[model samples]
Target: MIKFANYKKLYLIPKAQGLGLSKKLMETALSFAFEHYEQCYLETMHELKAACILYEKFGFTLLNEPLPATKAGKFNEEIVPLEDVNGETITSDEINQTESTIEDLATLKTIFKEDGTVTAGNASALSDGGSALILMSESYAKEHGYTILATVGQHAEIGCDPLYMGYAPFYAVESLLNKTGKTIQDIDLVEMTEAFSAQSIPVKKNLNIPDEKFNIYGGAIALGHPLGSTGSRLVTTLAHALKQEDKQTGIATACIGGGLGIALMIEKGVGL
Candidate 1:
């Protein structure tokens, strides 16, 4: 199937910006995309006004609404119930209250070796919870005449420095790409755990993943993380995001404690 463009994050050094350099970069990237595909697609946030203008100048039309992924009537609008680590029903007020403001985040204590960036407010909160999913064989699923929403593509686990455990997802993504023979350019959506702003931010910078595709919706930084269920939660979120975004193929990755990283590549599921 023909897919979307790989262009997203474009950057120029601070001193070199606003010299038409951004447009030059987009031209080069779009030139590459044109060579490989008939059409190119990109997404940007409202804050990137300049970039959005540049995209529009290049003939990228802005859509008024999100495209639907499934042939089913429309995107699922189910309201998911949320609970905190304490098993108490979490209200929207509680979620809003937990939002870390710049001042609140600044006041948080740095826990990881005094790194000022790894603050309690920026890192995911500790919580008690778990998640479970039933994985049936493809053959079994077909025999039961069940509709499939997605299928597993690839998975990888890797180890990294214990002291810098947050970099685990980087290595995991590397290993996963190696296994699938696909570049980061092939990924449409990504669900990287907000283990800490310190960890997630740098990795994204190093990889050049666009802010739009990395986590369009709020993540653990906004929602509290439940230890064992965090990965599963990411998977669930990615699945729905793919459907909502009307795209296929995504990566869900997490940095684990004790120097480990895990990643899974999943596509939107389809009926047999």
Candidate 2:
């Protein structure tokens, strides 16, 4: 198993379902991780249950656990205000108490059913985008011209709420820390999407993470959510920004519909 250290995540991609490409990609990623690091790492959603299952067969474990309350508090402060498509402000309190059902998210976008809590404010903003990253052995990085970004420290995934389709990040975060044998004090900031404040708010309240360490930049609510692409973008931006800021450890998280959530831990230097 290649762990993330000098070895970096070169690229993370998801092929269209039944395209016969995902399996091939997984094989390549595992081979890379095995040859480079202690364990191979990547994250995905339940929408791709098949992909998740394949990774598990290769030894990737599903992340499942709750974060410490103290960490959650610290993370919440990072959340910036969100605005609806109408440009009206969206509040977290409004999201938790929302009546938006999971079914609304299945086929609806922008328009919410009558009395829909999925109003443009409380749902994931849909958009289309893709991203990629390149990682190499630390020696290779220095030998080449790669400016080393944050190294992969640890990662986790989980299924928190199957119905509301949120609350999974908290579990994923906890699982990652547990696997890495770490705690919140070791993390500097958290990069997470505002798919809904319901999940985001619980993250802070549950983990007790300070607000400043959570969202330095605005989230999906304000910038617009990009569905399947959100996690990749979040992790990419975290790596680039952490390297630019010379920060130590940072965590990027995403909660998808159908009770799926993913978390990634990165450090200034590749870790053991």
Candidate 3:
């Protein structure tokens, strides 16, 4: 019998928005979850529409009312990842992870996957939320006892085919590279929103970014994307990731609806 699962606090930095790393991470996590458990549940504020959407995308449904048994309790056994529904884990060493198909959607129609490249599973959820940071001069930060995590070196925005909105990040990154006089090889981490895996996948290929160099933690697809706030979210995620991984530089980029893209280059600051 299938059981229930829960996903707790998940986030990313601003510089890494629009890259589908979140979904990738979620896939691995979910595969592991289903292998050991059954249903996976995530809780989020109603205002965080994108996250809620992501939950639904992953075969989760919203309850009209709160659970009657809300008391927390302990579990007897620890869960572990062993295999998926098919008795096979999606891993390169054993088996390839094929793109999710209509069969994956028990109820919802497959959106953007046919000719589009983005399926309901691979696309970002519509979200509502915000994130921010306090920016000040080095003198002020030092005087005020503020610890800087990263320094913004460059920013770029560009326009592209409106119909093919996913590719917008490509041009933005291209422009930022030109302006900063740095190539993609110089970047250590990237936060790209999984706005649509269809779009994000192409962006990764075009930029020639190795899978390991991008969204090592995950992207918006699984984490939930808050529209206006995602830019700041990526930056914050990147900052923390740099400190945790002891890396030097990273970039956060996103593709906006209506033919637009945004990218930011950041360098790691002092310890943390």
Candidate 4:
């Protein structure tokens, strides 16, 4: 679900977990997402510390807030510690001045608990998959009838103990509001990947976005994870839904492998 308007960076790396799959995906995706903006943004998990180190190379940093990704240890035991996921220690120093937050680690742990705060019910379903999308400017959208969802607002990445890898959405959403002139109250809907139920519930409660504003259609838990594609998938899904329903301002984000996350906000077209 990774959608980059006016950029062509949708590359699929089969069985990519072994050979820096996350890095390659972002390298291409960023090239695409940023082609239209002055800057680029993304997120990840502490569980995938290796990927975290690499993204810093491209100016990807932690923001004052975190992106969203719920936990899934309750429904399944698929999740592991951030260190276990990377097989190496990733100190914050290595991440440098990258954007991130404090709640990230607590949220990371919640993603892998059998009865943790974050559970599979709300988090995204883990599986092997990839996705891509193309967003266009208003002028271009009008020319092509590209359905306008929410506008890409702000994004950030954060880290923590692998256990709570699900709380990133809090920061990611907060930053989006700060960047644009909006708040959770202004957001009409959201398409958060179902990494865990805890991830979404807490974020909704904290941000005051309301349950109705989140994943109306089936999320990753019901559909499928498709890893690399989840971020872009959320973006496109939100936009498509907003346009179809004639709403304004939708947000999307996904929990990444390396203790991080990615996010975007789209402003719906006026009175459709």
Cα RMSD, each candidate: 17.8, 15.5, 16.2, 15.6
- Candidate 2 accuracy as lDDT: 0.52
For 115-168, candidate 2 gives per-residue lDDT tens digits of 332334433344333456666788898888676666776688887535434557
Ranking by TM-score: 1, 3, 2, 4
On lDDT, the stronger of 2 and 3 is: 3
Best by lDDT: 3
Question: Against the hidden reference, what TM-scores do the models get?
Answer: 0.62, 0.56, 0.59, 0.50
Cα-based RMSD of candidate 2: 15.5
Error of 2 at 35 (Å): 42
Error of model 2, residue 61, in angstroms: 35
Give per-candidate clash totals.
Answer: 2, 31, 30, 65
Over 1-272, each residue of candidate 4 has an lDDT whose tens digit, in order, gives: 33323434432333223332334543543333323101111122332232332322211111211122222112121122234244664221111123333334334443333443332222344444444665557678778877544456556555543334455667666776787778777878887755544344455556776546667544664455664667776776677667656777787866554335556766666332
lDDT of 1 by residue, 186-265 (tens): 88888888654545655565666776788655556545566467787788778878877887889999876556789999
lDDT measured at residue 174 in model 1 versus the true structure, 0 to 100: 84
TM-score, candidate number 2: 0.56
List runs of model 4 lying over 4 Å from the truth.
Answer: 1-124, 140-151, 158-163, 270-272
Please provide, for model 3 over 26-126, each residue's C-alpha lDDT reduced to its tens digit, 9 standing for 90 to 100: 45422332221011111111212234334344322111101211111111011123454455652211111233333454445555233322334555554
Error of 2 at 63 (Å): 30
